[model samples]
Target: MIKWLEIDGQSSVAVARRFARTVATAAGFPEVRTEEAVIVVSELASNIVKYAGCGRMLVQWMPHARGYRLAIVASDKGPGIGDLALMMKDRQSSGGSAGIGLGAVKRLSDRFDIHSTPDGGTIVACEFLAPGLGLHPSIELAGLFLAHPDEDICGDRWQAWEMPHGLRLALVDGMGHGPQAAEAAGTIIDMLESHARLPPSEALGNVMRDYRNIRGGVASVADIDASRGEIGYANIGNIASMRLRPGEIKRFPTRNGFVGNRSAEPLAEAAAAGRGDYLIFHSDGLKAVGADMLLPLHGHNCLLMAAWLLENGEVLKDDVTIVIARVHGRRTHAENG
Candidate 1:
């Protein structure tokens, strides 16, 4: 489950920390690890209170090869950090204290990332693993999903897993808002997870077959083969899928129909996506006019790029979801050995 907290003032810091601690403990984190997570949350919330006046925090569970990890993400619309490198120094204070907050967060997290622009806002994401699970290199993926204002559940959902061939991904946007929409989208996600071993087209067909009679949704699935530098994708309805390579952005084709109610066969398309290429899948809730803004973020970390798009993209009055995957270059002989 994903939880959200608003950090509006000093009191909100304690609230955010408590929320993080509760989530960590419930996720089976050890007491010591839970304490570390609380500290990280405290520091991040404090930063927002001191520098940004107000911000938001998202806490969720992230799956890894060994098990699950805690993912804490903090975002603020305040004046962005001007010098990220300087701010990361142990003693360099942007808010006049000892300034160890961010440095400590980086040290405590198994995976850490931060992105900020002078005028654009700042987003910090950290992932904490259970004890004895050392870091391992995996395919890069990041996604964001938000419900429409005044809604408790988001109708849009995304999921990805590393397969033996490479990575398989799915993005779904239900027909409308609220509980029914969430159920439709979530059911599609469950189907995708269960039938992940099938090819994209076949997997989607299976989902559609089982999803008949339910509220319909638009969906896209992709199989990324990093070893072969290729991607196989299929989509039904309006979910947008795109491939970004050097100097070009190729939008994949999608058939017009609903997944559960009625749909045409979506032929899987193959395309080259070498190292440094990015594959993006997003629901129609993202405005078409703002789609071009993704060009400049081509080479950045997937998490940072996703956050930036979520922050700047025009979100309609519906649930929105965006998923990004980037292919890493071939490993060196020394690293492989």
Candidate 2:
């Protein structure tokens, strides 16, 4: 379960102390480790007040087969860190500009990762391993999309895959919005990643069969070939996929058909393509407008753009999601690409 906590100032300090005691007692950590945990909480809570005005925190303790582990996440929709280096350099910000709080927190934790956008706010996550515990590294990506503000449901889903084939991207947006409409879009993502390498059409067929049990979902799947400049893509329904090419806005739109329920089969054959593809998939949230309107924006800035678009009521009201895959050599670029 997830516990949501909101606090500011000395109250935040007191609450962190109490919460640390509770979690430490339940997990039976050594007094030294417990004190470290408390300090971690205090630093995080204090930073919330000094930076984001106020913030929300979440704590989750999951019991392992051997013991237990803790995860903490603090988030705020405030102006994000514009200069990560200045924020980390300790005493680097001009005057008494609240730099120590973040620098200290960074040094106190075992593992930490922060996601921030000039427009979308920020999320800081830390994971603590109890004595004698260990965890493998993991990767997570989340995308959200909404339809035209006037529309009810947004058609899109984001999924993660870890396999020998590397990471795969799957997104689905149903035809419309409502519980049923959302279910439809969600199901496409569900079926595609259920197996290692099932043909996209077969996955859609299976999802359609299952749709009888639930509503249906529309989806698109792209195999990201990180080594080569290529991506494999397949789509069904009104959802669209595109790659931001060097000088072109290439679009791959699936034919019309409700996934699962199968309103038509002629359009259900999978659409597959080769490399050099900057894959983009969306429902009607995008018209003929291509990535030319989008590619110039920095990758991190793209999400901020998404958040702003959602806030300003420019796109459809339905949920909206955008995924960009830049096929590069095996090296990973940490600059939010």
Candidate 3:
């Protein structure tokens, strides 16, 4: 599960620390890693309140080759650092800049990355790895999700699996907010997990036949067959799916109806996929705006790209989620051989 928090004052530091520890522990982090997570989260939140005056963070237990780990992504619109290299020095900012904890945060995280610009802002991503995971897929993927400010639970859910052919990614949005919506969205996630062997359209067909106790919602699913170098896609309702190439984007079409209902026949189609292509899917919570245009900035890090899009493109009062899957060539196969 992912939790999003806004740091507006010193009060937020404790809350962020608690959230990190609670979620990290739930994700099976060892006692040592959980304490490290708490310390890192506190430092990040304190620096935001002390330097930026205000900022936001997205914390999630994310999937990794090593295991499900805690990922902290913090960003702010405050004065952006002009020199990131200088900021990474071991010295503190002495209460005048935004680089107070960069060196320490870097040291604490297993993986860390940052992007700062004078015109835009700064985004810092830190990841901590656990000890185990089940799948070792060739391609890399990540997603970020949050509930509406007015709601307690998110109504959007997603899941991905390393299929025999390649990767299968699915996202579904419930009809509305609150418990019922969360249940509806969850139904589809469970369905996707159970129906992993089926193709997108057929699996969705199974959902239509067997779904129960939940209001209908939109859904989109994609199967990327790296061996064939193509993607098979299917969608229903308002979820947006796009194939993001380096300089161009091709949006996949969706039928106009709710997914669990007698909606439209979920037709599946195929398209060529390059080694570096990114296939993205999101609910109506995020508009299909210019996320395509910013590919140059957030393209290399799918987790950061997902976080950036959710933070910037959210439609104000709805649940939002985005999944990013980058197609890597036959690297896993080659490594095994």
Error of 1 at 26 (Å): 1.8
lDDT of 1 by residue, 1-337 (tens): 3325788997888888888889899988899999999888888888888888898887766544345667787889889888788788765778788546677788887778897777767889887886665543435776767777778888887777668857888888889877888888888888888887888998888887777646888899998777766688988889988987656778888888878754466557878767777888888878762436877776776666666666677778778777888877464232211
Give each model's whole-structure lDDT: 0.77, 0.55, 0.76
All candidates in order of lDDT, best leading: 1, 3, 2
Cα lDDT, model 2, residue 12: 68
Question: TM-score of every model?
Answer: 0.88, 0.55, 0.87
Candidate 2 residues 190-238, lDDT tens each? Answer: 5665753655555555666556535565667666545432445666666
- Report residue 36 deviation for candidate 2 (angstroms): 11
**Candidate 3 residue-wise lDDT, 156-203, digit = tens:** 888777788778888889999877888888888788778878888898
Error of 1 at 84 (Å): 2.3
Compare candidates 2 and 3 on lDDT and give the better one.
Answer: 3
By TM-score, rank the candidates, best first.
1, 3, 2
